[model samples]
Target: MTHEEKKKEESHGRPEIPAWMRAVAEVISAPGYERWARQVAATGGCSAPVRLVGESQVIDAGTGEVLHIYRTADEPTGHLLVACGNRRGAVCPACSHIYQRDVFHLIRSGLSGGKGVPEAVREHPRVFATLTAPSFGAVHTQRERNGKTLVCRPRRGGGVCGHGVPERCGARHDGADIRVGQPICPDCYDYAGAVLWQAHAGRLWHRFTLELRRQLARRAGMSRRRFDALVRVSFAKVAEYQRRGLVHFHAVIRLDGPGGHDDPPPGWATAQLLADAVPEAAGLVQVLSPDPGNGQRVLAWGDQIDVRAIVVRGDGGGLSDEAVAGYIAKYASKGAESSGTIDRRLSCGRCKGVGTVTMARGPAVCKRCGGVGTAGGLDLDRLPVTEHARRMIRTCWDLGGRPELEELRLRPWAHMLGFRGHFATKSRRYSVTLSTLRQDRAEHKTAESRQRNGLPGPESTEVLAHWRFAGQGYTEAQEILAGHISQRAITARRIEEQRREGA
Candidate 1:
């Protein structure tokens, strides 16, 4: 067509069918789906919903044989409706808002004793602690307190690294500084060591916990194996990425009796005792491996260990059980990609240059400006170095594989490099479990649905459903609608929370 005609056609384009059309089609094709479709259509618009097509056998109560066959226009079509559980704020806000609310409830339950947890747990010796990775090199940092800016890292000048760069930062940086993650001198940073350390951080934490238990047992004047019979330790932890792209950890540790929820701890169990044990355990713990290239690599916790006794007032005091639990739940849904790493494997052999990193075959190189010898490069023979810089190097091989160090592998989390532990894990005695919390929420949702639908009873005489994974994303129209829904949900929740607090 001519350019003028094409312009007109583009300007007056036909309205595209809503993506929820599939769901509508499924509903129309399923047995008794016509009624449900009419109900759904009356609600105006739902960007996307599950579409199922199937047959149902309706049998008489007194007879074993089927009394009737109910089918939609398509004999085999059956459809079921299920909520899409998307939690990203940028994507489906409706699902994300629901997810966030569930998380809040889950966390609050763990803190204040609901969802099967004993209320007495509020008195348990619990502390919210943060463990950070050691600095690979100095970089830009944001500093602010009481509305005033401060020097990012104000160390004494004149100190120099092995590479002769100044070891201190003097610049006053704002919160929006883009150079925060960049090393002051890339060569001076122990990139290999940092990545390798990250890869084995989960293992290190495991060892720390085990050692902490041992130390606690010794302190209590009991044998290591027999400690569980007297007292049990429970903890929930989440990993956070620092400005330098290294993973650190935030955790809430609690002490309880041997029988978990059924019993209280002995009088000897106190927050002070747990606090003391943390640093000692951290210091004594070590992960050893015989290196083929080097003689051996002895990995130990960094010197910057912090152990605090969390209280109910002050800076550390304000760290309530609810707040700690909420913080952990928020981080659980995140992945490494949230911190700016590529979620998929970098492509081989495609190098552009300097500013742009491209994933392609050959060696991983910057797509914008080709730069090699970094974590994104194709030097597989060297090591998988990038964000964790130190740990992914060849020198750290067998770091988490020693026979004496089986507890550190975190084998369940192999996908997250060697940091194979749950984003949040709790010992049985802590308070409540994630499973119980989820079930409680589910039951609440079911009851709410029943109430809204004005069901005759809790039980349903006939329930039919079918569902499939259409895809896990939203179209432009759905995206807009989801945003509005999410905003409303958030506002409503905030108001509710405020009302509850006021009451």
Candidate 2:
């Protein structure tokens, strides 16, 4: 039958299938189905794969001979697919999973000494340190002691804040309780102070590092210059968004020789000494935020600080290299989403992010967003964000307007709750870099492909490439298929792991 006749026939006395299912059926029956599947599998089922139309030539440099040529037109699908390497898990889980693995190796290689690092570096003094943001207000929290849960902020006598809200919470809270990070009295919370602290968090960390070095020098009874010549501090830190919509740093701090991890640390450098210096430095280090109409405020680390020695094994009440690496890597893929904020940027629905719109009266500041260009504008109560997060975002918007604070760009990062620093960072000599790891993987993949295709080696050949962006992401049907492929890949890896363990 003709195409039109076949469609008419199928429509007779039959329930219509969903559009997505029909599209999937079309994909499965297509001639290029196998090739598309292979491409998707290669990307590890990336949710938003970038499509490229390109041609590449591998030529003999000495003889000017073309050994191999690749063109997207020759492929079954008219495009080459590449993974969107977004690190945020909420944005791209498959890519983020790969990124997390890379981060794990990057951290572990420094701690345990592998991937070009000397094993002797393991003897260097190192500690796992947590630096927290100072509290802006009392919030519902969960505490535990001796493996038993404790009530949050109990008070001897009932008291109320200036806003007439209770100043204490006596009830025990679960880990997943929605109110765990909420302020006991939103009206009494120092929203401006919190936002300013978030903005200056990076600066506070820089000052803390400097103070840590100074403290270490003082402990060893040496001048700052003399200490710098003898010892080098290295660290790998990840910023985690707490339930209170603020970020705290989890860092692995190590003391190495002035030459870096390759050199032996000074005799006086020890894990206990490094741990002792951490809290002292954190306590003393502070940063002053830009004045935003209100009075300037001092930003400092919170009172609670944790510093623990890192051990090769966890047998001695210390963290192991594997556990520490894994712990930091887990947070590398997260962001402010944990605090009930949207991952994507929000623009004013009324003004469409242009700050002002033509109205019946005249062009005026957007009443919805207070001309700040964010959704829900001045009326944060209507936004989906938590009350605490809403207040933080509102503070960010308000402070972002002041000319003095313009350099901080608080409005652009308001989604991040005014924090605009890289979530994962490391000192220069901490370990192998993420870029190096990625390059090595790419080179290995290229070599494998050349070997499989029986092509000449890179040393004997030169490569020239041309590519242009075609598109990104997937249709509903493609997304469904990619999800299935991702699940299968995960299952296969799990099975292989189990088999290896059994063996």
Candidate 3:
């Protein structure tokens, strides 16, 4: 007997198959299964694909000839499947892998040369810098004075804290230890201040940029305004969440002439010059916690600041361009998933008909409980199960209501723990954008499709299409199948990445 038949026979005495499973079985067994499978796989097996119901007509722009006509009703599933396009790996690995690659190219293009960026940028003054968050409280950490592995923490009397947590860990803790970044005492950890710091991290980075420019100007013997006329400083940065749930900055800071990329920087601009200014700029920059209604508080970069010169091929003082690009790109697709938090937004829906939240224009949303998109009136008690997340969400709600903090919009981003900034960002001239890359890809795919059908190119042909969102995700059996497809895709992507690295 065939393997499929044998499998079915072996399950004869098992519990009845679910209806969704039966549906999947029938769909796969249908006459047009191959075509249907191909269409589904086109989306790279997105677990939750957006279903679009619509029709399209490809016409000849010059001749008014109808080249191709398509309808949603004619599709394998009577709906068009589109990739959800979520950048977070926790949400969609297929799409996230794509995002990671694009980010890599974007960063690489600025460092080396490609996608219209000049190779001269490689000679430009650039530094790979890491700016970490200040210490919130004493957490378990492995330290090394020189090359020797030092003790985690040592105390004379081995006393305990007020919360009864040990003051010292005599054990030589490995980097993988669960308590590595966790508070020595959870009660002693300043959770509120950490969340607040995350909320204001964007402001801190902004001020740092300003300070860096000022430092550069001082070194050039010119005012900040005069320095702007001479040269422009560009940066591409990514925010990474630490094990302690703090956001740290990783950046490629570059200096270019007034024309940017096209012109060379002044003779004074050098790798060493930029590297020296980083710590000085970091030291001078500070952001105050919004009148916490308590006392004065100043936030600055932590003691562990690293600035390395990025040399091309031969000489090297620090990290290489490839390593820097790979590192930043790797973190572009990661979100709150690293911090034991939800990457997707939650709402008041958790209460289940505690009455839907009515939004200002439409229905309200209990942001954390998953009610809707609105997040004004959620009770801290009704939030998600994690006490850790609940407290952070509460801070978002409470701080959002404060008049001085309104501009920060903490309520809308409560799900993000008050940090509303993009995970990755670049200056205007860093490189091509993700949007431009996507459009180019779309055009290439269209060209390939046209070649297959022996049709004219887009210059003379145009597509007029109408689409609507129908639904998302898959049935039980389909979900199982999709997981298999996703695994295969992940494997394929990894192989491609490995091949590129080897080359």
Best by TM-score: 2
TM-score of 2: 0.90
Give the winner by lDDT: 1 or 3.
Answer: 3
Cα shift from native, residue 378, model 2 (Å)? 12
Model 3 Cα displacement at 485 (Å)? 2.6
Overall lDDT per candidate, in order of appearance: 0.57, 0.87, 0.79
Q: Point out the higher-scoring one by lDDT: 2 or 3.
A: 2
**RMSD of every prediction:** 8.9, 4.4, 4.9
Tell me how far the alpha carbon of residue 283 in candidate 3 is from the true structure, in angstroms, after superposition: 1.6
Encode model 2's per-residue lDDT on 14-124: one tens digit a residue: 987988899999988989888998898888768899999999999999999888999999998899999999888999987888788788888998899988888888889
Give the per-residue lDDT of model 3 (tens digit) for 1-503: 99999999999899997887788787678776676566667786566778899999899998888989889888767888788888888888888888888899889988987888888889888899999888878877777776777788889899998988888887666767656666677778776677778888888899999999999999888999999998889989999877666789999999999887777789887878889999999988888876567775677788899998888863556777898999999999888757645565543334332334556797654455455334344455675434555666666767666777767776667677767788888888877788888898788878898898888877788899999899987777777777777678668767977998799
Span of 10 residues, lowest total lDDT, candidate 3: 347-356
Task: Kindly list the per-residue Cα lDDT of model 1 for residues 390-429, writing each as its tens digit.
Answer: 2232322234334443444412222233344445555555
Error of 2 at 167 (Å): 2.4
Stretches of candidate 1 above 4 Å error? Answer: 1-107, 143-148, 153-168, 289-296, 312-318, 343-420, 448-465, 493-503
What is the Å distance of residue 100 in model 3 from its true position?
0.5
TM-score of predicted structure 1 = 0.68
Ranked by TM-score, the better of candidates 2 and 3 is: 2
Q: Which stretches of candidate 2 lie over 4 Å from their true place?
A: 1-14, 347-383, 493-503
